[model samples]
Target: MERNFLRRLITAPVAVALVLGLAACGGSASDPGTPGANALSGSDQESTDKYTTEKVIPLEEVDPAQLDLITEGTLRVGTLSDAPPNIFIDETGKFTGFDNELLRAIGKKLDLEVEFASTDFSSLLAQVQNKQFDVGSSSISTTDSRRENIGFTNGYDFGYMAVVTKTDAEIKGFDDIGDGKRIGVVQGTVQDDYATNTLGIEPVRFYDYNTVYSNVRNGQIDAWVAPSQQAEGQVKKGDETVIAESVINTQNFTAYAVNSGNKELLDALNSGLDAVVEDGTWNELVKEWYPEREVPKDWAPGSQAVKLP
Candidate 1:
């Protein structure tokens, strides 16, 4: 599965843009005491508190043998720890997010313990395909190319690609990003593909999200294109950035992917997902993670109505 960008940015109430000077002026986005400085102290404290108090469903009732897990009693999973609102390593070194929570819930249902192995987003699918991990849950979007090597459960969320720029930048949206504009995108992501193949603009590639936000804030790049939720997370963390409303609204269905031909495990995941949706767990998660948007009523497993290049 291909990686997609954020949705959180699209739903966030627009904050007043901060005026940051150009890169040539030695402006730093990481500078403290500045307006919208990307500070994480508050976020770290909150994450620590949340992880400490959060209650999970008990798993004593379900048996792992029935589910046929990779490690007998454990669900070995692979994911990226930097993607917020989906899966991210908190300041306390614990994985926390909607995706992590959902996977934990699935583990409870299957009567299996979840053991997560963090990897680079670019290598997540390959690891899952090679059976190094039984499943991957990194907000992965089901793509034609990925379907060849992996099997995806029903999509749990929709991810939209967005363009983020410094508040004072002239570029407003995708159309404004001409050849002269330096665009930053995560390497191996759908955003990278879109910037290169669809828009025909070669983007300044970054391996991590923090670098993209820093570059944009420092005026090193004209704009950063990524998942709306991820971009929104960065903005919320005090980055002086603004998400363009005119985004590339690709309806990418994000799902958990298993190795190709692992029909038993795939079926079990789909069943667990169906249970969550039916029991209102899915709705609760959507509200918790994406309070700005309504839960999709017709969403189901393997539902990818809109395809992207």
Candidate 2:
């Protein structure tokens, strides 16, 4: 009886474990009913359809003054500086990555100055909702529960989940993650949801990508469940960590988060996104940042009305 109880305790959702342990390193809360909570399941259509809007408002229709931005004529974006390729600050001290650059192009279409600020992934959504920033641009995945707290623009990217382990660790992939192996995840991310709610394994949560990846390197954790893009960014040559496996997880399309009440701002950003896609800027950035990644046939960024070139 004691052994079975211990097993059950260990296998409980990560959120529950965090609650019991009073850990500050986890996400806000887990809602199992949220679509795409399980990265291992769902179809491309199922994931992308909800984020697709019927129409995108023209940029000319949006008035920056009426939008109540933190700073007029500027988009104050909250993003992570540690996660590279997608969202990170370059050595030149400029925020220049695929996600930020794409947002900058979108800003150009709207004639708005795009300024970025760094924040923890765990607090970004709430900060956006509270108007600390005009938008959250951390390559956030759209989910139903998240919508209740904040609004999201039409998806600009899809994602893949990966299992990053030390080269010598026995964890080969997602299948090898559970059963008492110490797994690390960045708090408040979909990767956290996958380990906590989908796989039924409590994870050691960290506040940022750098810390979690450090733990994986130092043998403090056996594996790190992370977004494939960020994992690839952190695991460089001479780093003994290897991406054991990665699986396509378009279950949730990644979009920028805005305050749910800010319909005007959301529509305007969506419009700018469509414009970027139309101008070939979107395609150019995709090829530049993710040259090796093959976009799924069924998936493209922007609204349903926009067609990818």
Candidate 3:
């Protein structure tokens, strides 16, 4: 009788476990539901709560890289070498820009060696997604779409775009900006999307921002619609022909986007970002590069790819 009673208890527990196991198998949170970053297809994850940002989350407990710190010194960072004052190269063949300096500051806090791998801004998303680098330092924009794949740090540079041209240019607003104007865009970027869709203009695309700038400055094209920060660099560095007008596309936000799965790296990046913002590092970078305008929030490539604010 005692044995039978114990067996009944065991059978009941086993039945419950089997039921719960089946439920878990059916509803596991990690299940890839749809396309786009382990999401459920045909399901609108727009309501997914994962996008809700925790501004000051700590990276120590969360980031996986710390757990596997094989190198102990290097934190490979990805950046766009074209966005001046944010991430760009100097005439001396040195990487000297806004994001360049800020990311170095982050490296100091983490006690890690920093290496910059420069590529097209569009690749920032894909490379970070693939773990090509530890963090993305290019001034990336944050949006619902980008959050789907890569995590984002708090905003760094926030500004608008400018209508730059050789003539005392007549490209006043978004509408006329593309009207009969041969617009230029960096290849494989949200800028290309904006040029093709919103601006209603066919973009004279280049492989990188420098080419876009080169083509615009040499008067090979009428104007170049680039980030205000990039345009600011050109203006400060003496691009006489290009003029930045207060067009809508010119004024947008940007941020440093990182791949999402690496919670440790994301946390560290955000923590470093918080430190930077607190010690006035963020604002100082703003003042150093853009002393002329008010810096807003942030922008990311592939971030919703919405019209520039």
lDDT of 1 by residue, 240-296 (tens): 688874232223356787887776677677656655655677767767887886543
Q: Each candidate's TM vs. the true structure? A: 0.74, 0.85, 0.70
> TM-score of the candidate numbered 2?
0.85
Error of 3 at 74 (Å): 1.8
Query: What tens digits encode model 3's per-residue C-alpha lDDT throughout 1-309?
Result: 000101111011110000001100001112222111111112221122233244555434444347233245777777776677778877887776877888887666666677887776666677767777767776564444455566666545443345567655565433355456788876655445455544445779787777877787787877776655676676644566655453222122356666677666666666666666656666676678667755423332112211122
- Per-model tally of clashing residue pairs: 12, 0, 24
Off by over 4 Å in 1: 1-63, 66-68, 246-251, 298-309
Query: Whose TM-score is higher: candidate 1's or candidate 3's?
Result: 1
Measured by C-alpha RMSD in angstroms, how accurate is candidate 3?
Answer: 17.2
Q: Number of the top candidate by TM-score?
A: 2
Per-candidate Cα lDDT values, in order, are: 0.62, 0.75, 0.53
